[model samples]
Target: MKRKVVIAGGTGFIGQYFNDRLAKSGYEVHIISRLNNHIMWKDHHGIVAALDGADMLINLAGKSVNCRYTDKNKDEILKSRTETTKILSTAMLACENPPPLWINASTATIYRHAEDRPMTEAGGELGEGFSVDVGKAWEQAFFNFKLEGTRRVALRMAIVLGSGGGAIEPYQNMVRFGLGGKQGSGKQMFSWIHIEDLYRIVLFMRDHENLSGIFNASAPVPVSNSDMMASMRRAMNRKAGLPAAKWMLQMGAAALGTETELILKSRWVVPERLEQAGFKFQYETLDQALAEIVKS
Candidate 1:
């Protein structure tokens, strides 16, 4: 029998891509989302029934963390991750025979500032802020779940770049109209990964049973904000000019309940564990990744 895979938030950006990839790879993919009035309880039970003789379970359901972290936004962020994970975990444990692997989505923002050094999975420091706290809570919820036969892998992803959604589309449009520039000092590190590589990494984790820990899913090369913006400008055949001031970012993001840290903070992260595990990146350079995204 072909392997069956269930994704909790499989209708979202990364989940959609992952589902498509798994389907193409011969795995029967099923998504459980709130859409179509698909309640968590009903979806969970249905998925459990489907997974009686299945292969993997991937949970990528959560609100986007890019918004302002106000009290309300913060609650949504925390609850979205924790609640979804909890529901899925409970369902899996209730299953007569759970899947073999459970891959949960995580973020690299959990890592603390490294100044100029890049963070690796082995001994990287975690950041201290609202976002970091949320990441901690999210991971903790997943860790607390009891699934006897399920192997878990937490993917600490970086800025995901793609065509329609994510950071690329807006930035690309801004650059196209000559409004795009570097944020803050332009020195802060921007660790990123192409959507293609991200999907590939997910597929890899599903296949590689030995990979059961936190994996930093980012490109091998970490670039500065200035370099990334310049690459974006080049990709759009535009010229770079002024950088967005720190105060301007603070003022703008303030209304959104976010601070300048979202843009100004430096996170020099590296996929040390993924590389060590013999995983390869399709786009290791910012320019190459930007070029591909633009062309696509």
Candidate 2:
């Protein structure tokens, strides 16, 4: 029998990449989603069956925070994370042979907007505000589960850059349209990881049985917003670009149906634990990641 691996929320950008990669690697990759295909989130018995004797379970089930944080969105964003987490945990509890490894999705934004220092697993401080609060509650729901049979890990991820449809595409469009210049003050730190590296980190943790708990999944070297914009411009062969002021960004964000914090926040995160465990990142710098992503 093939090894079974379950991915919750396997329809999003990151989830699609993981599903494709794992399926190609010959594992029986099953998805637990709200969609009718594969396994539905409402199907408790289906989920329990999927988790039965599975090798790994990766939960990425959360509503997108890309839109405006209205009251309805906020409620949905919180429930989508916490409720889905509880449902999964409850199913795992019902299984006689639960998955050995459970990797839950968390965000690097859980840490404060630090400009003076970088946040790491060993020394990072949690931040306040709506996004941070959601992250805290999400992790709390996952960790509150008493699953002695499974090794749990909460991957605090940074902004993921990749080809086609992620952070890179918009920047590419901006550089093409001459809006590639920095947003707001442009001094805010931008912490990011190559999508491939994020996938590798999951496999790395699976291989290293000793590794468990919270680990920040970001590139070792984070750049400022100005630097990130400059790198994007360079990769796309653009010379001069238009910088957006805070007010302009606010307007743009409102028009684009997204929040400005996604662009303006200083997220200086480092993968301290991954490095200490001897996991080498494929794309260590933003330039390297942007170069390949732009090429594609």
Candidate 3:
């Protein structure tokens, strides 16, 4: 019998990757989304029916936080994460045989901005403000419920570098356009993981029966913004890049309809629990990851 996996909001970049990999692994994958005709979120019965008898449930449903965090966008961003997870929790609780494992998406932004050291699950300090608050509230919703037989895990992921659909694509495009230089002081740490490694980490967690709670999904080594941009330049065969100062980034973000904090924040994070669990990353360094992303 094939294992069944239900992925809520699994039509995005990361979700597409998981869909492909899980299908190849012989797991029956069903995507629950508003976009899909088969499984609409408004229908609670449909969601419960899809989740019933499934081996695992992974919720990646949330509004994208890449744009300017205006008042309306902020409300939607926080509500999308919490409300979607809340619905899933409620549906699972109603199930007589709910998924054995429930993996909810979290962010490394939950930790305070640190240039001094990397934040891990056990030793990291929590941060305040909008993005951090969203992360905290998201995790709180995931763990607030007590499903006796279900194991829960929050994937506190860092910036994921992939070929087409992640943060890397925009930076790669900037490098190609000769604007891919360090932002602000360029000393902020950027922790990231390859898409493949992230998928493997999901598999690792699925297979490990005892692994529960918050796990940081990121590469072991973290690079500074300057180094990361320079590597992007090298990978894309561009020698010169116009650096963006803080004010310049702020102005540019306003014009581009995005946020400056996305680039300026120093998210120095590490995957300590995954390391202790003996999971090895295929693309460990920024340079190697960029090279692969550019070539693909």
Candidate 4:
């Protein structure tokens, strides 16, 4: 009798990785997604049925925020996260035997753009405006419902680095094209986690029953933008990187149809709770994580 794990909106980048890890761990994995073969999100009956006998539920359903933050895109970004989470909450509350543990995806951007200090789960100062509002709203919707037996955890993840997908490839491409340099001031902090470690963190929360509430999912060692770009060059065997100024980033982001915030935001986050819980990170530092990813 293997434990069943249902992933709501589990067809995206992080979801796919989690799905693979869960399946390999011998959990009977079921995906409630938009795919025709899986349980569709709109299929109310199917959602309820999926939640009925689950041991765990991990929801990673949301639109990518890699593009330009137009008004329409902003609305969709907020709605996609909040609404999908709401639906899962609705379904979970209705279940007599709901998942004992429920983990939802969250962003580290909820914290203020701080260069002076690192943001932790306990004492981090939250930011304001569009991105911050979105993060706050997403978490708000997730914790709004109270299921009797369910222990809820929101994973406030930083930029997840890996070989197959995520922020690594684009940077690699930039390095290859000789455009890899520290963007803007190069003083902004960049916090990140290896994807493999991310997998372990999820399991850690699931296995540790007492662990509940928001946890920042970033590596302990965050580096400056210049240092990261230099490391990227070293990993790629490149000699020099052309630095991009603030104006250049603005123009480039506009031309590329993406938001500058993705590059400009100083995400100085640290996983204090996870470490304090005795969860060891395989790639705790940026260079080590990058080396492994570059080789892969």
Model 1 earns a TM-score of 0.93
Compose the digit string of candidate 3's lDDT tens values, residues 62-121: 999999999999999999999999999989988878999999899998999899988989
Query: Which residue window of length 10 is worst by lDDT in model 4?
Result: 287-296
Cα lDDT tens digits, model 4, 4-108, are: 999988887778888898999899888998899999989877888888889889998888998889999999999999999989988887787888999999999
lDDT of 2 at 121: 93
Q: Give the poorly placed runs of model 1, Cα more than 4 Å off.
A: 37-43, 254-259
What tens digits encode model 1's per-residue C-alpha lDDT throughout 147-266? 687888998988899876776875776577675789887889999999999988877887788888788989999899888888888888886645678887788787656567767778
lDDT of each: 0.82, 0.93, 0.91, 0.90
Model 4 alpha-carbon miss at residue 171, Å? 0.8
RMSD of each: 2.0, 0.9, 1.1, 1.1
After superposing candidate 2, which stretches have Cα over 4 Å from the reference? none
lDDT of 2 by residue, 1-296 (tens): 89899999999999999999999998999999978777998999999999998999999999999999999999999999999999999999999999999999999999999999999998999999999999999999999888897999999999998887867777788889989898999999999999999999999989999989999999999999999999988888899899999999899899999999999889999999999999999999999998888873
Q: Please list all clashing residue pairs in model 4, or write none if there are none.
A: none
- Per-prediction TM-score, please? 0.93, 0.98, 0.97, 0.97
Shift in Å, residue 144, candidate 2: 1.1
Better of 1 and 2 by lDDT: 2
| lDDT of residue 25 for candidate 4 | 84
Clashing pairs in 1: 111-127, 112-125, 112-126, 112-127
